[model samples]
Target: MLPEAKYRFLSEDVKRRSGLVLGPEKGYLVESRLAPLARTEGLASVEAVIDLMMRGDKRLCEAAAEALATHETFFFRDKTPFDLFSEVIAPALKPSRAGRAMKIWCAAASSGQEPYSLAMLIDEMSGLRADILATDLSGKVLEKARAGLYTQFEVQRGLSIQRLVKHFDQAGENWQIKPELRAKVRFEVGNLLDDFSRYGRQDVIFCRNVLIYFSVEEKAKILARLAGMLADDGYLVLGAAETVVGLTDALKPAPGQRGLYVKADSGASAPVVFRSATAAA
Candidate 1:
């Protein structure tokens, strides 16, 4: 168990750096997540790791905070959101911007699965084109995402056998995403706490599942920033359990869409985008 002061410092430092709220009850998580980092740094114990951090070792402190980030993801996690993307959003773009590619940002794309799943869905959309920019806070996970390699267990989690065969090539005991599919996503290291306006406006922002770690105020701040960068007609996809209802006024939910949000006063009716200009009219 970590000493109370050390625990408080660690939690506060992590929240300051990553906006992740690690409550006092999450001590087990801190210990587990920091153990490998501790071992790598040749620390005698997790306490020693905290000791170095308390002394303000910048590099170690950064690594320790990053180590606590949750990267749990799989291909097409929570299928319905991707379904809405393909069925509603894809067809919606066909009429107004049929030939032009749309921009999609996977704001917390861990290890590439969600972005790759969307890339595959884009391919299935007849005559549709899109660019995917997937970002995460962890360089270690981004490296794995860039490689697009997955073990059998990893591939099996959310991928159907047909999708597995169609999109991945066998690599001994593992599977690698096809080069074409791999080219569809560009992965980068991004911290939600940092400025990212350089990536510019996006038509679809998949900032799913990561916001639950933040306080309500922090969630509102992040959503407001995201709203600033979202095209008026664009969609902001959150995890099913997440909602902007009490957090921010900048966004309103897409009626009947479980995790979709859009800009307030968006052209998309009731914040649910139409399939074509005619449909909107």
Candidate 2:
């Protein structure tokens, strides 16, 4: 167990660097996540790792932050959102924008599943040209994402047999995304708390399942920043469990889509009704 003073410092340091709020009860998580780093760095214990961090070791601090940040993800997570994207968003975008390419940003794209899924959907559309930018705070996971490799179990979780055969090629026991699909996404290491002006205006932003770790104030700050980066007609998709309600007025829920929000100034249009084929099952 980490000493309380060290725990508090580490927690505060993580929040300062990454905006992830580690509560008192998360001491176990801290120990579990950092202990391996401690072992690898030849430190006596997690406390020793913390001491090294306190002494101004920037590398250890960054590794600690990466260790604690959640990277949980799977392909087409919560299928309804992808369905809505393919059915409503894609068709609406193609005609509306004429010849311009659509830009989609997956702000917390852990290991590439989310953005790759978006890429696949975009590839299926006849006339829509889309670019996908997938970003994460951890360079380690970003590296993994760029490689486009996954275990059988990971691929099985959210991918159908058709998509599996169509997009991935066998690489020993693991599956690697085919070169054509892999080429569609660009991965970068980014911190959501930092300025997003580099990403410019996005047509759609998927910052899903990431806000739950943050304090309400941080959530508001991130959402407001996202709002600033969003185009007037852009859509922002949050996790099913998350919402902009009572958090920030910068975004309002889309008229008929769950987990979808539009900029407050975007103006209301006829609601797009999405009925997922698999929802009945």
lDDT of 1 by residue, 28-127 (tens): 7787678767878998989999888899898987898787875668889989999999877777656766667799999999899999999999887678
CA lDDT, every prediction? 0.87, 0.87
lDDT of 1: 0.87
Name the regions of candidate 2 deviating beyond 4 angstroms.
1-70, 270-281
Where does candidate 2 have its weakest 10-residue lDDT segment?
A: 264-273
Clashing pairs in 1: none
Work out the TM-score per prediction: 0.72, 0.72
lDDT of 2 at 135: 93
Estimate, for each residue in 1-281, the C-alpha lDDT of model 2 and write its tens digit.
67888889999999998889999998767776676688779989899999999999999999999878856578999998899898777776678777888999999998999999998888777888888999999898988799998867678888999999989999976799999898999999999878878988999999998899899899999999999999898889989999999988889998888999898877556445597899776
